[model samples]
Target chain A: MPSAAGPLKTTALTRLFRDMGARMVDFAGWELPVQFSSVLEEHQAVRTAAGLFDVSHMGEVEVRGRAALEVVQKLTSNDVSRLGPGQAQYTALTTDKGTFVDDIIVYRRDEDDFLAPIRSFHFIETAVGGTKCIVARTGYTGEDGFEIYAPPGDALDLFSALVREGSPHGLLPCGLGARDTLRLEARLLLYGNDLDETTTVLEAGLDSIVKLGKGPFIGSEALTREKERGPLRRLMGFEMIDAGIPRHGYPIRVEGAETGAVTSGTFGPTVKKSIGLAYFPSRAAGVGTRFSVGIRGRDAQAVIVPTPFYRRAH
Target chain B: MSKGNGIYPEDLKYTKEHEWLAVNGGVGTVGITHYAQSELGDIVYVELPAAGSPVVAGEEFGTVESVKAVSEIFAPVSGEVLEVNTALATSPETINKDPYGDGWLLKLKLADSKELDALMTAAEYRKYIEEEAN
Candidate 1:
């Protein structure tokens, strides 16, 4: 259901959000818009032209004090020195033995603010779990953009301002449904969908984020060990040919033997077919390699393709 | 996105899968229905059948993927993929705005004119939506 402006006086942001036919959902105790128009309309708008989303519900906290940058870089896997102002990067908040604490987009704005997709404690989620330093946002969307970090109260206002300014161009208000399809098409891993506490980064096919030879990071020892020892399982993207769409936890069989399970699957708008991401043995992760996705009782033909299911025209 | 002023034309016969066929000669010109496009919302991508590809009745000819969902464009009747709306690659929303006209997904030559009677009339299709809803 959707909420009309109540308690708080009506404002432009409130009215605009309501006018878009937004399905309001309570996320982390704050009111957030889930979908507007339809999940399909918003999702396609973002992929084709531009879709603006208000992520004001996301909270931001600071960890700056000079040691801020180092504390963060050591705590995260990526080299954060490159982030200056508008630039941002993707890094993980990890545990003592290479377990994932959270996946954070580290933004080095006026100060460092790491936006955790799933609402959680900003610093304690990363640092207290065995972080060497602080973190912030870098690259998201694979498009030209950077995330600005501020407290929820401030973020709500700023996001409203951004929509006003960005909408004059081609930016139309988008919702969470668009966000999910957008990232999945890019092969970007949403923590819960593709990564979890027990799932290590190496198994997620995130060597791009892990620097095995870089200076000491929190999970360096175990991560580097996994790198040297070789990863046991790896992530792969596949397209369904004969089988029904493989959803979360759908099993994968390699020549009648269980190989891995699907992490996520859905109709890929850009690919025009049902595509999904899953983890399988490293040897079976090659592109074009065939596998079977067990749906209910019958199995479907699924072949490994590249990580991202689609590539948009630049 | 604007399908001009007219989208659902009166002269065309519609298939349950949302395709409309207008027969003039030995060939039937096919397109998506206005109702079909509206149901699809914003179309981000489309797959066109190759020219002259033989199609069968009740079989999938191609697919149309909106921002939210995807569905196969089933052959309204047995035919061949005569021609496709090439403009769809640049403006997929035409399917949403003028599915029966500019957004016509593809055209085909009827394998049998008898198949035409098997389709629903405009009034029948409208009543069909009502029945499906109830």
Candidate 2:
């Protein structure tokens, strides 16, 4: 019961947790729920059927005006030029030097209102406050989703409304653990895990988000150059032939030599095998390239494959 | 000994690292105790040492990951790995259901018979764990 009273520093969920029996833990400084039922049960629920994530902890922002699409197109990676009303596209808001601000999703909910899913709740406030750009290019979840950037007083209520609506369409209050697994299964990079301040999206295998032919944005020039020159290192996925699970920074050794590092690894329930993604030298990133995972100083056999180790059952 | 978890066995010898060993004669078996698996949670994948491989004393051997965090499994007593419960590889949850039986991680030929005396009996181990809990 430490005095948890702050605006930018304190989590918005402090009020919600007091009532919901949520076991809160410090996640990147935000006190968020780790689990409601259990981590395993929640993870399985999402994989088997549905999950409603309390992404209220995440940020949301909207861009409004006639030049909304132009601002979005210039700032983000997706081709938002032909975006019509109510349509959304997954993209990334990158830095001017071809680095990542955050991987995001764009929602064209209506004619004038454009929604963005930025990284965290504070990002929207910062974006609106720091950069006086007329429009908001904030929240990003990489889904055909809309994150509402409104007053925090009513944000939790809006989240509940979405859960009430999305529940019927298959949504459960998913915690952070399942969120990590889901994004990793999709081979999407997390901020501190895969894409840091130095880790380029190019090395993270996020080229699809970039439109090299598109007009000038913040980092468009550097990205266009990198695309033509090709990346020095590239991201690739692989399955664990053996039982041992690799983790972030676990050395991906080739022929007893440490060649790369596993950015993400997990037991893929859908694929029924241990799958992980890693960054390796461009020459060694080819699919089917056999490698070894150095676990606790012991070398375990591994192999390079493709993105998305799991295919959700249709 | 587990945070009031009554699921531990007294006959088996345990390590501070959480591995348990049960040896009757030359044919000794190793596995994580019920308390250990419960603490670890639903194990998604298990890396079992191959049959006939030599495991040293207090050596790191395997790993288990659920959703958010991952933990490692170690060797309790040094011996030659006789056999691994292969079933745990495909369905590691057997550890959750039967850590004492089918969930038994591996079988080993106890390299030193005197090492058997080095482990704690069920009641004593239980007492030791209960003390650690507080």
TM-scores for all predictions: 0.60, 0.75
Q: Considering summed lDDT, which 10 consecutive residues are worst modelled in model 2 chain A?
A: A132-141
Candidate 1 error regions (>4 Å): A1-19, A26-31, A82-86, A109-139, A146-168, B1-134
Return the interface RMSD of the candidates, in order shown, one decimal each.
Answer: 6.8, 4.3
Over the stretch A1-314, how does candidate 2's per-residue lDDT look in tens digits? 22355433345655565466554556765767766555666666666655655555567688998898789988886677755555556677878878878877676654343346442211222233333222223322223222445456655665566567777766666667666666677676777777765656677777777777778887888788888888888878888776577788888887666776888777655455677888788888899898899877777888887767555444
lDDT of 1 by residue, B24-53 (tens): 887888777766666555676677678889
Candidate 2 regions with alpha-carbon error over 4 angstroms: A1-25, A38-40, A61-74, A79-81, A85-87, A108-172, A254-257, A312-314, B1-4, B23-28, B53-56, B65-69, B111-134
lDDT of 2 at B66: 65
Expressed between 0 and 1, the share of native interface contacts present in candidate 1 is 0.20
- Candidate 1 per-residue lDDT, tens place, A214-294, comes to 688888898988888888888889999872556678899988899878887766656667788988888877898898998
TM-score of chain B of each: 0.88, 0.87
C-alpha lDDT score of every prediction, in listed order = 0.69, 0.69
Clashes of 2: 16
